[model samples]
Target chain A: MQENRSIPVMDVLIAVLLIAAGVASAMSARHLGKSVLEPIGPGAFPLAGSFLLIALSLLVIWRAVRVGTTKSNVDEFKPRPGMAVLALALTCAYFLVMQLEWLSFRWATVGYVTLLTAALFDWQPRKLPAAIVSGLIMGLGLTYAFTQVLYVDLPS
Target chain B: MEFLLPAIANVFTPMPFLMMLLGTTIGIVVGAIPGLSGGMVIALTLPLTFFMESTHALILMVSMYVGSTSGGLISATLMRMPGTPAALMTILDGFPMAKRGQPGRALGFGIMASFAGGMVSWLFLALLSPPLAEIAVRFGPYEIFSMTLVALMLISAVSAGSMIKGLLSGFLGILVSMVGVDPSSGALRLTFGVPDLETGFRLLPVILGMLVMSQVIGDIVNINQPIERVQTSFRSMFMSMNDLRRQWTNILRSSLIGTWIGILPGIGGTTAAIASYTTARNFSKTPEKFGTGTEDGIVAAETANNAAVNGALVPLITLGIPGSVIDVLLLGALIIHNLTPGPLLFQDSPEVAYGIIAGALVANVFMFIFMILGTPIIARLMYVSRAYLIPPIIVFCVIGAFAQGNRLFDVWIMLAFGVLGFLMMKAKIPTGPFVIGYILAPIAETQLRSGLMVYDSSFLPLLTRPVSAAFLVIAVLTLFWPFLMKRRKAPTAPAHLEDE
Candidate 1:
């Protein structure tokens, strides 16, 4: 079979996103003209950076196309993203719960840690208790450390 | 020298001593763990330092820097898995030596070499930084501007992966840093009408998200990967005088190489170790013995890496330029304490500057003592379950972000940067340049504008000014040196041929 010689999808996506970001930044910065005291103003730096970003992003796309796809590069990305995504979601939910003032920092953290740890533990029946205990220790320990020792005002 | 006694006295006081002790212990434990790094631990600990005195906080962080660099040898020797990137070269000789029923010997050599390196570089840091700061204090706006440019370019050029990607990451960082109100003119530029962004993203949230949370996500993904634990006794954890006598030259050479590399902006201990290891192999009579458990190899790698930790501190204290990724966090710590880093720092807060120098020496001593006494316990701690560790680390990240501004908005920003960092990692674009660029952009911009204003907007003095011109030339050369070398090495290409 012929080798698959296509540009990496990730690179292409990244390049596109960078191009968009550069364009957006440039557009936003264009209106802020130069300041009187200095010839170059606040917008000048960002504008230059945006242009360079666009140029470098174009180069990235060119390089990716020229190099084509390699087996090792494809193999290198064998990440189990499911667990990572779940962790991120759980973290977001934990933050939301705290933001909503649904529970105190201590309790909310305990629940968050327990659930996340249990999930990460792959929900093994034997490991669930260990996870819960770890959660309690970490949540309570962190709350005390921050509030009492460090004097950080944790949300109630 | 006058500042040294006061600094020593300040550090030896009970509270500062305890904090240093605690920081070193924590740093060692974290460094010995495979997935955790010194940078992540320092970033997470930064907010906690907010409550402490600036001197104590700096002492704690500096001590952590010393300890973490020394701590990587344990796992590298025992398990053939490097605890930190700096220990990478150690694995070649260290693991083989351990496998041959000499684990303690490997670790002993490593620990001694680490101590030697730290002691050597601490001397350089103490002797060199004051004079370097004297010269740097004379720098004009144009000179400073060009110097910052050189630092950024050097980092991007030397960073792993594609140069284009590194530059892009750096530029993106600079752009991100431009989101708030312009410091000089007080004009809003890139807030996008969000009230939260009017003040801009603070350093803590961005750093916590990128360094700590991203790693946590990665840990979660790879939590199931099996680790092979190595068993060893603590009986032979001390090297003999004969061994030290034999390896003295090798240790000295590696430490010197490491210190040189560390003093250069953006490069860190890993590079220092690699360079030293290569130099050792080249100089060795028994070059063939390198990979299969050579004492010289272990000595070279460990000594160079530890030396680099102190070497990196040189530029940070003297020029306000971070010598490595971890030094960037140190710079952030300085800024958090409202102490401006650079030559002015030495003038205004001689205590802080001298404290760091004295603290490094003290920390090295502490690191040596701790690693010697606590290796067995640390080896056990290194294998702690990720299921428990990851969640707590994430919670710390949340609290760190929230504690920064006492707002959930900062936490959200932290999460956003976490995802951005994770994606950047997947793309193999180094985060080092990004953070450096973010931190240095304002300085670069302000200096350039000030220079321009002084020169009547001509932009000619940037080239006409000898120091600034020289720095700009170095920046350009650094950026293109890789491509030049590539062209020279290409068998089929003409010497004048350009890369795409």
Candidate 2:
């Protein structure tokens, strides 16, 4: 079976995003103070960087297109979108749920770890208990270790 | 010489010695874990040192630095996973050796070389840093600006990827650094009206997000794929004297290379390992054996990386210029202790400088002993499931971000950067330049402005001043060297595939 070697659409999207960011940054830099005596204003460095980023973004797009069109150029790996989405959702959920103050630090961490592990491993009967136990130990153990030993205050 | 005895006495004390031992142990464990890096550990551990003495804090951080740099070899050898960026080269031969049923031998070579490298570079650090400081103190703003620019260019040039992309990543990091209010003018340049923007992005969150959190996310996305972990016998964990004797020259050469690369501003141990590995390959009688489980490859990589760790400290201690990402954390540790890094440090607080130097020597000894004895134990970490390992790393990231300023806002920022880092990796953009760029941007800006003020805003002095001129010339040459090589190699290189 032939391997999938399509160009990453994400590259083009990132390039577009970076270009838009560059334009915004450059425009904002112009609004900052720039005197003849001190031409290297605080904005000057960022403005230069924005332009470079724009150029580089275009280069990346060009490279992506050129590579995508080639028949024999096999890009061996592709990003797994299903896994990517799942991970991002879990990450966002972790932060968002923490902010809502619905659960204490240990409980929230336990829930986050347990749910994420289960989701990643398909919630197998054998793996589920192990995941829950591991979550409990890490969540409670780390909370105690950090607060008491390291003196770091975790959000309640 | 005068400070040496005092420093030794200080480090030999129970608290300092215990802290070094604890830090080394923690660093090795952290660095052996696939997604956790030494810098991440140090950044997280920084807040915990708030109540500790300056000597204890420095000792802990220095020991961690040595142990973490050495710890990376274990995972790289056993699992083909580089625990830290510096260990990337180790995976070239380390895994191959493990696959050939010589995991212990490869690790033995790596650990021994790490010890040699660390000790050799510590000597250089002790002998050279003070004199280097004396000369560096005389540098004008223009020279410093040019030097930093050279460092940026060198890093971008040597970074893995197209040079332009590396440059972009670096500059973008500088753009990120610019988000806070300007330090000199106190004027907001790019905060976009957010109150958090006033303080700019903290290094801890930015670094954790980029280096640690991103890796966790990546590991999560690939958790279903199982990785084989190689085990080694205790007997094979130590090299024979004959084996050590044979590689002495290679070890010395690599140690030198690693130390030199480490001292260069903004560079890190990874580059040192690469340089040493390549140089060792070029000079080897059995060059073909390098990628085929040869001890030479592991020695070169391990030795150079550890040496570079110590070498990086030379600039950080003597000149306030950070030689690597980890040193940036050390710079923060110094500042937190009310000790400023630079030449004045030697005069204003000689004890701190001596303490660091002495700590490095003792830490290296500890790293050597721990790595040799604990090889079998740390190897088990390689078998831990990604599901079990990665989530805790994320938790650490959150705690690390929050601990920096005791703010929840930093946690969100870390999450955002985590996404950004993941995207950049997917796009093949190197993260090293970006992180280095962000860290150096403020220094670059301040130096540039200071230089401009001295030269009455004429940019000519940046090029005409002898030292600054030399540095700029080197930067330009370094930037173009890759292009020149690519052009020369273009005829033999296959088309289309090269661009990808």
Q: Which residue pairs come into collision in candidate 2?
A: none
Docking band of candidate 2: acceptable
Cα lDDT of model 1 by residue, B231-348, tens digit: 7877788989899799999999999999998987766898788779878887989987888888999999999999999999998899887888789889999999999888878988
Residue pairs clashing in model 1 are: none
Q: Write the per-residue lDDT of candidate 2 for residues B1-500, one digit (tens) a residue.
A: 88877897788799999999999998888888877789878876776787788889999999898888889998898888888889988988888988888888888889999999999999999999888777777888888887667656655544675676687678788888888888766678777788877898987788788866776677666665556676566567788999989999999999999999898765689878877887888798988787778899899999999999989899888877778768877876887688867766887888888889999999899888888888788887657677676677778788878877877789999988888888887777777677778877887798899878778888998877898898788778766766775686556432321431
Candidate 1: regions farther than 4 A off: A1-6, A73-79, B481-500
Tell me the whole-model lDDT of each prediction, alpha carbons only.
0.85, 0.81
Candidate that would win on lDDT: 1
lDDT for A50 in candidate 1 is: 93
**DockQ per candidate, 2 decimals:** 0.63, 0.49
